[model samples]
Target: MHNPPRILAVDDVAENLEIVFVRLQAHGYEIITAADGEEGLARAREQKPDLILLDIMMPKLDGISVLRELKHDESLGFIPVILLTAKADRADVVAGLDAGADDYLTKPFDQSALVARVRSMLRIKALHDLVQDQAEKLAEQTKELAAFNATLEARVSEQVGEIQRMSRLKRFLSPQIADVVAASGDAQSLLESHRREVTVLFCDLRGFTAFTETAEPEEVMRVLNDYHEALGELIDRYEATLERFAGDGMLILFNDPLPCDKHTERAVRMALDMQATIKAHASVWRKRGHELGFGIGIALGFATLGRIGFSRRFDYSAVGSVTNLASRLCDEAKSGQIIIQTRAFHAVEGLFEARELEPMTLKGFRRPVEAFEILGAMKQEEKSAEA
Candidate 1:
């Protein structure tokens, strides 16, 4: 866009300068004149003009020698150099070119021809500068994009980890159900459904208040973590959803998001496995002078499922008489016992080691409800025996 070419004309003769300077200036070029090769080289280095018209024969460094010096200096090497000479000697022209002069003009050169050559060289230089500027800008943009992509990738990985953590929290549900909820945008959708047949498991630690009083905080934490590890594994193995932890207790749910025909059977199996794990852990705790026990209650019924609370902080939980009844059953259970409602027992009786327990009136219920004790999981042959 800025087309005012800066030209440097070098010659020993004062008369020659007037002719060349006027020709280049009339052509709209900004002109700088030097009387000798030494002064020409000095101006070229300082001003970095678009083109240099160098006179071959001059005092204090010949034109060819000055051209060689400018060509050798890396910073000035790209400036176009044109050799001006009086003699049209073929050897001198060849020598001048080898010294790095871009073009050669004889002393009798026409004013129009000289002006044309200078314009052509300046045009080429302008084009080269434009390309270089574009290349530099492109390189800068590329680096910025690469840095942005790296930041975006890091944020995506963090989001993925958070999703996994939330899914793990939903251990009370089956892994399939947990995956479904995790895949959804929000858990609020879980609450807007009709009553569905689902199994609920309630587990409470026996004498937890006493343990908290007597045991060191770290020791209590260690014991609770040990229990959670064993129980978490079993829940995952059976593909159950862990609804939420209620202090020293855990509530498990099954057959909602991903319905399973054997929901009752799965609930019974989980209860039995939990009971067995406690017994095994109890023995180890007793040997170390520590006491640990658990009580489990299971029920089956239609539950109102949904997420509740503030939009920013909500919980996916079931709300109905059945959930409360299950909690009450856990309180009514004794240490090392698995209590299940009569209806739940009927659903999975053939698949579990069970015994009929006393009928009792549950709080808020109209009448006493029949109940059963789940001894443990029953093998296929054991189910046949019970049948």
Candidate 2:
């Protein structure tokens, strides 16, 4: 609850002090009486009253002197003072005004006029207090807003840094893998060495070596560029991780770094897509007096995968028998052919038509490896009926 405003009345006559107290106290002001100027100044400083009423003819210090002292002191200077003087002395009234008295009430003053003056001074004091409170609140709100802006700028800077890091990752990793790594904020975990089952695919132009030997350097570069571009698109479409690309040869892996349930089917489909894409370019190459064909090999097995190389250069590669087996099968594949080992053939046997091939002896294998050639995907009606 709010406290009432305090008024200090200072007069040498006990009767005047009693009259001032009765009048202001009845109007709901808390009144403090003083019989002399010295006592009034002490009460004004100690109690810090909202208003002071002083008489001109006092015993100790006069009203004008008290007013000057009150105005001079920083802490007590703002308390409004009203001087009480006789009507005959106009010069004393002028002196009180010059001495920083806020208002005046002459001798034989009306009770209603005194009450009115007190009310006016207290109202002004309330407004000054309210303005001070609002100023303090505004300052606090400004500080909070500055802090919020600082936090927002920091978050924006962090996101920009993440985007730049993802852009650099795109140069090495596929778009899907790059996004996953950036979102998870844990590239080291993905790059750590681990062994897992994956489908490895290898592809290259069948006669790229001979073409490179006979064709001009610029022509060879153009053909290689076209071949890599087509294969790169299919690899991205299948969401496969590209391990490495050397000359016209490329290696891709699925179900590692990112898992895919239909990895075997994806690899076979991508290989067929490569053949169909090359067929369009084949006619153009033939018209230019050059012939080119594409072949692919797929194998499924567990392999150790991780980042491998020096600080300046590196690659995410797979190392195991599966990688070697895929390379050997790719080397043995003829033009427009896709060769797969027995394991991969079983995974997608129902989804595609494949012809079983005789067991063939391959490097690094003690026994001959069973293989098959995938013809094409089954028709939608056949797949749906089977399902």
Candidate 3:
């Protein structure tokens, strides 16, 4: 709405139009005059005036017809219209009001009343414009809010899915190592191919193949469950990364994915705990008439470790001579024996009592691999000092 409201005055008589134009224009109003109803509609459409004064009797179209046309048009419907009728009859006045005229005036207009009515209509139009503008802004803000909520929902869903996947991975990872993997900014970076000196321990039951051949499927599962439950606790206790467990054999790593202090000593301790645990389980198996023995081989050296296989099927694994040597040594070990190559035995020497074995050529190695059988660990006080 402008400071000086624009008004349209339509009359077939030239004298009436001149009077309205002169009077309103003198009172700080912009007046647009039209000679007939059709001409008034054209001027109203062009100017979009704040108020329209339409004459009842005009050529081409009457005031009631013009008012009806304006009321039906969405864009022009809300503009206030005042009807000018000379009849002074109640019927014509009612007809004008019924046709959506805001107010009406008789011929020989009163100048004071005309100004007051124009001021009132202008005030209404200004308030309506303000309300419409605010409504449009509110609608736009609501749209923006909906978009933001949709994006937030998607982000939350993605995060929840990631947590679910991490929970599934926890099935195979030690709790201590699982915490590290979860805290890392990029879990993939931890699995990317890299070479590092890691302590690899390979272990399996001594008579597992024979026992499985003779034992029922349920019995095999029962033994394996008991075996894993016992060893699984110790594995987590030592914070060693359990790479993979296949039926009985488990390959573990230390000083990898995240660094561990005195990794060699830790591996040896875990191996000793495992041997002791298996010894207790052996008596149970013996009672059931199903004999099983646990053996472990530990080796320390540089190895390549990373995620292996395609997108869906994969694992974080270690591959190199170190892993091979540990597996081969485990193959050569007797029931209840924990064997170690010279490289690893030397690393954690004096921490445990081990007997040197006669040099024997192991599979896949050109020279005889120097090895030792761990007999026992040092006293608790001395081991604590080593820690």
Candidate 4:
């Protein structure tokens, strides 16, 4: 429901107040009457009328004085004021206008002219209120936009920090493991010492030590770089965690930071891929009068794994019998061959074709370790039938 506009009429004569009340009320305006300037000022403050019809020559506090006071007050300054005076003298009119009177009416007022003046002032008041309301809303919207921008900046900073942390982790860990750590939002937990069953793969070139002894330093470095690059691509493709790479030797782990159901099979496939990739490089090395061959050894067992080194430098590594066993097997393997311990062999027995080798004594083991030589991955049909 909309409320009608309120008008405050100030006059000393009872007849004038009655006439204004009847005229404005007939036009759907709520009229409030005041007997004097002081009463008018009090009512104007209390009622907060939209317009004031103030008369000159009031007994206490004249119309001009009331106009001056209202214009000075912050709360009532914006309300429209029409000076109603019987004096037709131009000096009196100028005084009222100078005192902030918005409009004026002289002597006996015509009912039509009075209503028109009231309507005009009411329209002006409505426009002022609308402009004020819009200004407030715009201020609120500006504050909300500022808050949203602040939140967006904070989120962007947090994401950038996470990306930097992930990049640093990828330097020492595999891309797959680095992503896992970043998504979990907890790198410290992964670095904590723990034991879990993991497949360990150790690979290196045969006769690399001898080649390095006689080859130029630059030639040796070029060969090592080429060898590492080829093997590095295969490691990333299989999502294996690279533990370390020293010259021609490299160590990889599977199913530790990121769990894989077919860890042994993945290791075997990666080894075969590595062999195929190195074969091309080997041809080039031989043409250059260099002899080089690749060998790999794989084993599966529970081992303690954690970050090793100071804060400035660190590595994710595993330590247990499994690691030692894999290293010993790689040492015993001939060129172009993949060796597997009994445990790894049993895990992927049907997935790959392997030949059983006689139990051999290995370093750090009291008994001979049963081992097998992996020939290659079986065909899809053979693997399906075995499954």
Top-scoring candidate (lDDT): 4
lDDT of 2 by residue, 12-70 (tens): 98888889988888878898888888988888889998888999888888888888899
TM-score for each of the candidates: 0.63, 0.65, 0.69, 0.75
Better of 1 and 2 by lDDT: 2
> Per-residue lDDT of 193-227 in model 1, one digit per residue for the tens?
55777888899888888888998998888888888
* Better structure of 1 and 4 per TM-score: 4
Which residues of candidate 3, in runs, are more than 4 Å off?
A: 1-145, 164-172, 380-387
Question: How does residue 163 of candidate 4 score in lDDT?
Answer: 82
Question: lDDT for model 1, on a 0 to 1 scale?
Answer: 0.81
Q: What is the lDDT of residue 50 in candidate 1?
A: 82
What is the TM-score ranking, best to worst?
4, 3, 2, 1
Reference-based lDDT, residue 196, model 2: 90
Q: Tell how far residue 333 is off in model 2, in angstroms.
A: 3.0
Q: Whole-model lDDT for model 2 versus the true structure? A: 0.86
Best by TM-score: 4
lDDT digits (tens) for residues 159-213 of candidate 3: 8977875774465567877777877757778878999999999999988999999
lDDT by residue (tens digit), candidate 4, 1-387: 016998999999999999999989998989999999999999999998999999988998999999999999998747999999998989889999999999999969888999999889888989988888898899999899999899999999988988877777786667877888888877888777898999999999998999999999999999998998888888878888888888898989998776778998999999999988898999999999899999999999999998888967777889999999999999999999999999899998888899999998998999999999999988999988877
TM-score of 1: 0.63
